[model samples]
Target: MTDDNKIVIRERSTPSKLRYASQKLIEMHDQLIDRGVDKQRATLIGIALHLESMAQAAESSAGPNLTPGFVNEPGSTSELLPAEILAAIDVPPYLSTACDTALRVEPADVPDATGWARLLHARCRLNNKFTGAPCPCTCHGREA
Candidate 1:
């Protein structure tokens, strides 16, 4: 704990703690699913999205540090980390169809591309609809 009475978690290797957290999140996910939310979306939002937000908040509060950052180099060029993520996944049919239509249309097809871009980043974390609908980390642009 710090002067502000906040518990600070430093990064370290702890397999048992990680397992415990995972189990607890899974139990919470099951409880949430029982309440009527879709199982896939429930797990994604409850466990994955929440954890990601926590990680982002922790890193943000840590401020600039001499040690290298997690996702990128200490200093790197500007590029869409999120966009690059798209190429790595086997995109679902719904998203691929949307992409196909977008490619055929003119740039002026929609008035506010920027607005749509932000929204897409905020919400559309496409789960893998093929096997298990696991959460893809597409919601990185969310305001933390």
Candidate 2:
């Protein structure tokens, strides 16, 4: 078949990290139910699974518009869902605290290493800020 007439199907080479984590939670829930663990434990896992699904949906809807910074910006989506989900699942306090701490970091505090700069660079490229070339931002070492 000619290239224009041939059909093609492309699939993701691997599931997203969040999807894998959700699958693991499902496996844990199944194991708990099969082993006759307490109903409350299984119920908590179910809640976690639901929360993961919600997060996935939100992420999908946000798509390329999602910014990668702390939830400090007004009108931006809160980055605390992961921490809240951890708390709901009754994980150790330290783990939840760590999640909260990580999400609360200010991008300006670590501009070079933070996702905020990468996102800005991407926007710059998309806007052809450098004449249809990669952004010359210092974040990527171009000295702009």
Candidate 3:
């Protein structure tokens, strides 16, 4: 086929774990708002927005293939109370710690990788362990 006659197809990029988690939180936020329970819980929406921005920033900085190593499922909220849903999707603390760890890692450790790449790899290494877990480098909370 001639180049002009052939169709070009572009594959969609999969979202990183951070993006996925942000989406879940947004979903919960919408549901809570729908039921008139947003009140103090409305922060979920803001957090989700921040996470989306962070995901974009990470992608731009690390390359388009950045993916964190955590799994976040929103599960079935139909049977749960709004408070329960809030508790269920309370991921910022873990993510914050992970981000902190990612940002604080020494550039020398990852050699030629960019800041976002270091974050991505560190999150992967920490995988599903974002809950107050110490960074593998033993430098969680320490400034780089």
TM-score of each model, paired residue for residue: 0.25, 0.27, 0.32
lDDT of each: 0.41, 0.41, 0.47
Please, what are the lDDT tens digits per residue for candidate 1 over residues 50-101? 3444455455445643433433221233222464566677755443222333
Clashing pairs in 2: none
Best by lDDT: 3
Model 2 per-residue lDDT tens digits across residues 1-144: 245643222232122544554565666667776897755553445444544544555565555434444322222335434545545563321212222333444244652234333333332222121122223334345444
The digit string of per-residue lDDT tens for model 3 on 1-144 reads: 345643222233334766776777767776776897736443565566557656665555455322343223222122223555556765442333444545555454653234343444344323222233223334344432
Which run of 10 residues does model 3 get worst, by summed lDDT?
70-79
Where in model 3 is the C-alpha error above 4 Å? 1-15, 64-144
RMSD of 3: 19.1
TM-score, candidate number 1: 0.25
Which wins on TM-score, candidate 1 or candidate 3?
A: 3
**True lDDT of residue 15, candidate 2:** 29
Comparison by TM-score, 2 against 3, better one: 3
Local distance difference test, candidate 2: 0.41
